[model samples]
Target: MATVVLPRSLVALFPGAEHRVEVGEVGSVSGAIDALEARWPGLRDRLVEAGPSIREYINVFVDGEPAALTTPVPPRATVHVLPAVAGG
Candidate 1:
């Protein structure tokens, strides 16, 4: 999980409504989605895209650094995905 630590601002987005996450494997985002979906069925549709590419305003991080949207999943990495905040 590369010691995943959630940013304080984005706590409520997680389905768990508890701890954020620590996705250790990048390729396993789908796997994680599946797992989370099992727990909270609504989560899969809310999080993952039905086809390809994650939804907009969402960013993933690896190793405490920004992971490009085009970057393929890395092995044994850390991923933190959160929605972009905006107010106008």
Candidate 2:
């Protein structure tokens, strides 16, 4: 199982949202997302678009390295879901 960490900003969208989620036995990042979506219905929709691609404003990391949805998620790896930051 891999650990998926959610940014504080995203937590607001759900009731009783946890800062971290455990996705069991998932192979790809998308699978891990499916696991999360199984637990929280609307979560995946917020992270991905119609083509099942990750939204441009969002970023996902696997084990501290920047990764895309196709990135493999090994067992026990950490997946961080963060919003892209913008500054003036």
Candidate 3:
């Protein structure tokens, strides 16, 4: 299983959302999102867009490296979901 670290913003939207969730064998980031969506309805909407791509304001990292939906998720890898920040 891979460990997925949820963004605080996202966690706040879903009551009872865990900061870290363990997802079963998922081939790619998309699969992991699907697994999470199964647990928390509407979660995928916050992370991905219509094209099934990561949302413009969201960033996903696999093992601390930037990644996309197709990025491979090795077993026991750590996936981080973050929202982009901006300020003037």
Candidate 4:
């Protein structure tokens, strides 16, 4: 199982959302998101867009490295989902 760390802002939108969740047997980032979606409805839509790509305002990282939907997720790895930040 991979451990997914969700941003607080995102978790706040979903009641009972946890900061960390364990998803079973996910081979890629997309699979991890699907697993999260199964647990928390509408989660995928928040993170993914119509093209099934990561939302423009969102960023996903695996094991401390930038990642995409198809990025491989090794067993027991950690995935982080965050909202992109901008400054003037």
Candidate 5:
């Protein structure tokens, strides 16, 4: 199982917004997100677009390295999902 870490922004949608979850048998970043969505409905939509691709303003990281939706997720990897922040 991979450990998925969600940002505080998205966590608000959930009851506890605990911000962390463990997903099983995920092969890629998208799969990790799928697992999260399965547990928390509507979560995936907040990160993906019509292409089922990661949204432009959203960033994903695997073990501290920037990654894309297709990025392979090795077993027990840690996936981090964060929304981009901008300020002037």
Candidate 6:
């Protein structure tokens, strides 16, 4: 399992989850969403989308770099997902 840190907003989505993980390279963000959907079928409809652009309000990182929206993530890694809120 990967150790994931999520912003407060997203934390609500993963109720009772202490950490987060996807199926690894065989999967991607889509996979994570898939897995979550499998468990809570209503989840995918809320968390994922497909269009000309992904939502700009989010910033998902893996090992501190921006994560691939479609790239596969490995298990046993660290990931962070947060809203793109910033200010001077």
**TM agreement with the true structure for every prediction:** 0.53, 0.93, 0.95, 0.96, 0.90, 0.62
> Candidate 1 lDDT, tens digit per residue, 1-88?
4323344444455545435554445364555555455655565565556465566666656556665544444566655767767789
What does candidate 4's lDDT look like per residue over 54-73, in tens digits? 99999999999999999999
lDDT of 1 at 32: 54
Model 5 misplacement above 4 A = none
Q: Name the lDDT value of residue 64 in candidate 1.
A: 60
Give me the displacement of residue 16 in model 3, in angstroms: 1.7
Pairs with steric clashes in candidate 4: none
| Residue 50 error, candidate 1, Å | 2.9
TM-score of 3: 0.95
User: Best candidate, TM-score-wise?
Assistant: 4
How big is the positional error of residue 28 in model 2, measured in Å on the Cα after superposition?
A: 1.0
What C-alpha lDDT, on a 0 to 100 scale, does residue 7 get in candidate 1? 48
Better of 1 and 2 by lDDT: 2
How should the candidates be ordered by TM-score, best one leading? Answer: 4, 3, 2, 5, 6, 1
What TM-score does candidate 2 reach?
Answer: 0.93
RMSD over all Cα atoms, model 5? 1.2
**Model 6 vs. true fold: TM:** 0.62
Better of 5 and 6 by lDDT: 5
> Can you write out model 6's per-residue Cα lDDT over 1-88, one digit (the tens) per residue?
6555545665566576434544344346656556655655565555455672335676667667777557556776566666787789
**lDDT for model 2, on a 0 to 1 scale?**
0.90
Per-residue accuracy of model 2 over 1-88 as CA lDDT, tens digit each: 7899999888888888789988877998999889888888999999999887999999999999998889999999999999999989
Q: Which ten contiguous residues of candidate 4 have the minimum total lDDT?
A: 50-59
The lDDT of model 5 is 0.88
Q: Model 5, range 1-88, lDDT digits (tens) per residue?
A: 7899998878988766568888977999999888888888888889999976899999999999999889999998999898898889
